[model samples]
Target: MMLPSDFELHRPATVGEAVALRAELGEAAALYAGGTELLLAMKLGVLDYEHLIDLKRIAGLRGVTCAGGELRIGAAVTHRELETHPDVVRELPGLAALERAVANVRVRAAGTLAGNLAFAEPHADPPALLVALGARVVLVGGEGSRELALEDFLVGAYETELGEDELIEAIVVPVGAPGAVYRKFQVLERPAVGVAAVGNLVGGVFDGAPTVVVGAVDERPVRVGAEMLDGAALDDEGAFAALAEAAAEAVEPVDDLSGSEDYKRHLTGVLAKRAVQALGDV
Candidate 1:
């Protein structure tokens, strides 16, 4: 990888200062936390910002805490933290498993959860489960802060709803969902297909309005409709097929190193069935 254009770096110790610098510099500036994504883009010459506002020096933005019925994950929380933190492992072991399976150890050590979501990489691992978990992201800007559903926050591949002056604050997930399961098919660094299901147990099966999110096969993580299986389930005749087909139909995949659009669409169904089944197993 070669270096991109030169840029000035500003280390800000407060969110206000970081947002202010971003607002002042406009689109020429970007808020930097873990450089895992931004640095790669810079190296590829896809992004070249004139000013980089480093947010690591800011306080109160690097830990995990639970309060008021939600797990508040700081924007700077690394994948390793999600994998090894005692609270994460104990309270949401399924989610911990998902984080553990995220790229390589080095990337896990350096990549922030917020960075991954904000970058909105098509093949990234977190979005599928985050959507299934009913996660919400808080965004801070020069004007004020506001929250958005994780699904809405992720607008498309390499894109988010974030404004030039905005910086992600934290990702918040509901405390207790019935049972959540994440499953994926990957050839190398990035997932080719990923599916996650979070459900509420009603009458010994996931009949409640369970969330099913499919990722990597499209521009963004897609919420698979489960209305076909509302009362029916994996064990029921035609139920699994309907559910899988619905999931596969929901995505419009772009062919790349992962596979062809047809192959990815097929995997979407396979992974969707397996993931929803795993929810029952758990």
Candidate 2:
């Protein structure tokens, strides 16, 4: 498959301008950012659009800021940018590590986090961690702006709740957690399973049930509450293994090229355990 050569590219300099283009063009146009996923889909003939609204030139949409216990990541912020951003490194190093391991260096340098969520690819890593961290997306359109939880925004594999006339403005992530960890198992281009665990530790002991999300094995990230780990010591292998088993059972993994259902389920457990252990080490 090859990209259609006839599609017109429209450059928008502002969020308002981008919204107007989206409203005017409707289904005929598609938002263009990093082009990491969109352009590939076009080339593969999976999507067709008569217009491509280029948003690279849009001002006020390419920086990251930390305030009021959260991090605001602009729509145009790329994976590489997030991986090394000072605020991200200092405040959310787990996320920075996750961003660093996204696909490869080329994709990291060119792919935006907003684009990743908008594409909603299940095998991707960010969604699981971001969802665990309680992230939200800010969307703008002709009707103005609205915010949606990352979990709610992503409907399923290759799908989202984004309106046809709306564009993602930024991703907001809460900044405080005792610590969080993300771990994944990959054999091909994408992971077979990804797990993220966020927990609060009080004086070196688990204070509450941790949030463990299993991704890449299902249509969307599956959030599993690790109640068994509540008040368990970090080195409690029995508790961590129980959490892993629960996470594996929580996801409805499909049989695909990534692996058989059983294979992915096993990977889910393995990664879930690793994620918890990693969080404890932090």
User: Quick one: best lDDT, which candidate?
Assistant: 2
Candidate 1's displacement at residue 217, Å, is 1.3
- Encode model 2's per-residue lDDT on 1-282: one tens digit a residue: 675657999998889999999999999999999999999888988888999999878877889999999999999999999999999999999999999899999999999999999999988999999999999999998888999999999999899999989999999999976688999988898988999988878766788888888888889999887999889988888998888788788989889888999988888888888888777678
Q: Indicate the residue-level lDDT of 229 in model 1.
A: 67
How much RMSD separates candidate 2 from the native structure? Answer: 1.1
What TM-score fits each model? 0.95, 0.97
Alpha-carbon RMSD of each model: 1.5, 1.1
Global lDDT of model 2 = 0.90
User: Per-residue error at 110 for model 2, in Å?
Assistant: 0.9
What are the lDDT figures for the candidates, one per model?
0.87, 0.90
Q: Which parts of model 1 have CA positions greater than 4 angstroms off? A: 202-204
What residue pairs clash in candidate 1, if any at all?
Answer: none
lDDT of 2 at 120: 94
